[model samples]
Target: MENPIINVKNVSFRYERENVLENIDLSIPKGSFLGLVGPNGSGKSTLLKLILGLLKPQKGRIELFGMPISKFREWDRIGFVSQKANSFNTGFPATVYEVVASGLTKKIGLFHFMDKKMKEDVISAIHSVGMDPFIHRNIGELSGGQQQRVFIARAIVSKPEILILDEPTVGVDVKNVQAFYEMLDKLNKQLGITLILVTHDIGTVTNKVTHVACLNKFLHFHGDKEEYEKLEEKDLSSFYQFDVKVLSHEHN
Candidate 1:
């Protein structure tokens, strides 16, 4: 009920030769979890990139916390975990502590050294994500699940109020995916951090996230879980053009 933390008004985006997203509008409240779902090439990642200010919108405006994203100065308040984190080489020669500490680079200001408080914050973040034992271990030595957690620690080290992730579960094992989602849910429910996740796991995410934003080259639907639940299989089949239903755990 608070003013929307993120607002997209008639926004549009396109690549070099094609229009990928059309006049899209969205509003996300603070302390909420929103899942963006759609088939491949649906502009889900593009939208997230726009929010992160990686790409400029072709038309319209995007506001964070009621101000134009361009004017917003609280970059540290938001955290981002991209799919690229999974591919980061473990042989990169960095410790988990160092990786997490990098998140405080911004807050430490330009050219400043890491202080005691920053180190403590990084350690706390690592512990929060259950990666304390591996804090001193080499990043490359960790498993895929452990690596993902380190990235999560990096994001949380900044103590961000909102966290956004793109395809976080991609390339991870089934058990690790569950662990990752559990961490996300904990951050949302216990820490009250608003979360926006762009993923293809509709069945799993739909049940966990507080809200849903379905996209397909445009904003198809953005509403609560109850609304998504009311949707019939036939309605979803039309969008997917095939049998569609939340995948059961048994199927996974």
Candidate 2:
């Protein structure tokens, strides 16, 4: 991959005496939707933290947008929506527009007013996620899947080049899960945003993401979706070294 957007080279990390990651090397290209799948305690979250610049690797180097992560200060170019967003307080009195608009705090300043252009950006983001009708509704009143869309709108309101989601569909109903992924597909394909989704639903996400990467303190596989689809269930079982049978789902 020439000038990959995210580059992790010979990266290793540890917490106390427990080695969390070992000689991990991964590269993500721009405009590629990567499904990062792994079992619990497989260092999936840790790798995300490293990529987000929240944690530094103990060994090796990380570069974002071809710049060393340590020197990379374009934080706004990367947006992240955490799994905790699904657990937001239901009683919080914030409207969908208000919640999404908050994402511009860094750009607009905490106390600054949103100019006409900034407000349009917020509305555009909401519309992009198909949440225009619910723009004025209370976030807590929306369904789990709807709330996730609002959160995604907030993340993309900044017009980030890369959007990273950690277990985004945790609280969504099974019926709405597929629609949520379809929306993500639109974001990756139409909007041309690079996406790195950390998820446990290997079976479901593989259907949407362009690439697949399996991690278990080590990278067992990293390739296009077609290549990943070619792997046998037994191979995935060995990669996880735990329990993560990739069950096939019936999608419409």
Candidate 3:
């Protein structure tokens, strides 16, 4: 891309005796919905952590908006959505509005009441995710798919320019997966948010994401969807056995 929003150059990371990522170079252009796919333990989460500034790479450099990650202090410009089911308590006693409103904690600071404008932003975010009807409903009472959208609203309520989602659909129903992705497409196309999605739903994402990056410790491929789609299906099925995670989740 001419001027990427996020850039990684020759980045290598490891844990204890194992190397997770090696000499990886990747860039995310503004307004691009890039899907990051690879096998489990191929450092997908590690790479995300590096980009989120949760962990630093042992070698090479990473930049956010052309600024070195170490010096890039505009964290509010980015939003992150993690696999919620693993951590969120289904019985948490909070309404959807209350849950989404909490996203402003860092931006609005602690113990301060939200201004009317902030409340409007929260409601608008919920509307954008098509969850405004359930604004006052209990979070735990909602289905997995509904909860997922609420969390996304929470992430975008702050009006972040970039959204990074790591397996955000793990608990969603099979039937609702496409709808989830459609909402993501809306966020990218309508809201103009840059998205870096680490996903295994290649069969669906290929139709939505602008770019695709195949990772297996080493980046096997990084290109536009059309270029990736042009590869023979048989070739992918045969050559990418090393990355079973991608092949296993190609469900349409």
Candidate 4:
């Protein structure tokens, strides 16, 4: 078996006196599409933050690409799309090309003009997300789904090995959500980018992801989709700390 791209061992965290996560262990291998499902306030987002090095765990360790997060400095190796990215100011004045090109600002440094290769990379990223047609459009003028795709292009502009998303389809219309997921699937399979998605749409994500991790201040379940699908309602309910049902649905 290949080594894990992301590893969390005996991780625990808290906010003041409240314990948010306790003794969490998870391993995500290369090319794995992992879905993180849990109820609200279940510490799903917190765990993502921990893995992203945005927050420090009170106890235990986390590794990204086999390097300890605390010592890891190669941030360009990972891409992140937050839940609030699609909610950018409607009047923000930036073109899609400009937005996607911003992903290289850190590497390019201040006041440095985009060279020919950088411009090609920008266009390539937009094409990867199927937003080439809107490459020149104003980012603020696009629909929520379109804007989300542009942000995804921005995230992948650097060609990161791992992509972490938190509730990426929140503001997107139902009609476009499936397409958004399809694009993500393409990125994972064709591009070979590892995916870690934190979402509440278990019914929808279960069909798309290769692995599932159930979280609620603790690691309740961690396994492949087949085993997750075989779980009983009672087991799921216990994991979520409430009554829940796993519905069967077909993916488009």
Candidate 5:
């Protein structure tokens, strides 16, 4: 078996004298599409931040790519799109190509020109998200769904091993959400990128992910999709402290 790409052992976090997460343990292997579902204030975002090395846990440990997060300096291996991504200023005034290329600025450095290979990489990333035609268009002119794709293109431009998105479909139109997920499925299966999605669309996401993690200050359940599907809706509702539903569907 392959080593876990992300490992969390007995992790705990607190904020303003309140515990957000308690004794959480999780392991994610390569090529896994893990969906994190929970109600408001369940610490789902907190956990993602911890794994991304943005916040330190008060107790226990976290490892990324087989190395302790504290010691993991190869940040390019992970790509993150936060919940606020949908709120980005549509009037930011930048072309899709320029926005995608900006993802490499950290590696390319400031005051440096983009060479031929770098430009080619940017184009390839745009194409991967099916945004090649919009490459020369201003980002502000694109629709919400198109803009989200641009953000995803930016995230994957570096060829990261993992992609983490928090509520990526929040503001997207309902009709476009399915297409967005299909694009993600391609990125996962075709590009071989591990995915960790934090979403509230539990009913819809369950059918698309390989694994499901139910969280509410602590891990209520973590298992394969088949096992998750076997669980009763009432049980899931009980864990969430409210009524919950898991809709079933066929994946294309």
Candidate 6:
């Protein structure tokens, strides 16, 4: 069998003087949607940054697409939708099309201009996230969920093979949260884009991701939903250091 799309070996990281991640090892198969879950202060975001090469690990190595992360020059292969990135003033006068078009900067490079095909691709990506109706609207003027969709469109505009999302549904309403996950499901299934999501939205994401990685300064547990079923509620509570109720309806 071939290696996974993403492979981390004995990785650890520190911030300033404190250790954030320790002895982490995992392999994420291609096209898998993974949910990284943990309580506050747990190195969830730090792990994502390490994978993105924003931060170098203090130990071990990370590989993407079967190559060292440092050697991967094709940045367009990975897309990122940061949490709270849409909270910036949508009222800043940039239209939705402009916002989405900005993501093509890497693919087109800095010196050249966006050609006709690139523009069409931007529009197509926006439509993929169901934000076509607001293509010309000022990004700041849209609601939270709409703004999130616009950011997602920006990510997809590059046609990335992998998508990394950090709390993509924050500040959205219940109905929109459902819509957001549905859109994610569509993107993963229809586009075959691998998704790695960092979120605290347990109930909503438990059933959505193909695999789950629970982290809190250390690897707590990671596997499919069935493996999670084998864990007792008390054990989970102990791992989290708080009361946790695994809802039957949601997990089922």
- Which candidate comes out best when scored by lDDT? 2
Score every model by TM-score.
Answer: 0.93, 0.97, 0.94, 0.96, 0.96, 0.93
Clashes of 6: 2
Q: Write the per-residue lDDT of candidate 6 for residues 8-68, one digit (tens) a residue.
A: 8899999889999999987889988888888888999999999999999999999999999
Candidate models: Cα lDDT each = 0.85, 0.92, 0.88, 0.90, 0.90, 0.86
Highest TM-score: which candidate? 2
Clashing residue pairs, candidate 4?
none
**Candidate 6 off by > 4 Å:** 248-252
Per residue, candidate 1 scores C-alpha lDDT tens digits across 122-224 of 8889988889899899988888878888888899888898899888877678867777788888889988899999888877876678999889887878899
Residue-wise lDDT of candidate 2 within 165-241, one digit each (tens)?
A: 99999888988888888899999999999999999888886788999998999998999999998998889989988
Off by over 4 Å in 4: 248-252
The alpha-carbon deviation from the true structure for residue 37 of candidate 4, after best TM-score superposition, in angstroms, is: 0.7
Worst 10 residues of 4 by lDDT: 243-252
Write model 3 residue lDDT over 191-246, tens digit each, in one string: 99999999877676686899999888888889999888876665455435542332
Ranking by lDDT: 2, 4, 5, 3, 6, 1
State the TM-score for model 6: 0.93
Q: Judged by lDDT relative to the true structure, which candidate is superior, 1 or 5?
A: 5
Ten residues in sequence with the least summed lDDT for candidate 1? 243-252
Candidate 5 lDDT over 76-150, as tens digits, reads 999998754468797898999999999999989988989999899999999998998899999988887888889
Instruction: State the local distance difference test value for candidate 1.
Output: 0.85
In the range 1-252, model 4's lDDT, one tens digit per residue, is 367999999999999999999999999999999999999999998999899899999999998888899999999999999875456898999999999999999889978998999899999999989998998899988988888888889999989999999899988998877788889999999999999998888777777799999999999999999999899989989999899877644553
Name the candidate, 5 or 6, with the larger lDDT value: 5
**Backbone collisions counted per model:** 1, 0, 0, 0, 0, 2
- Against the true structure, candidate 4 reaches a TM-score of 0.96
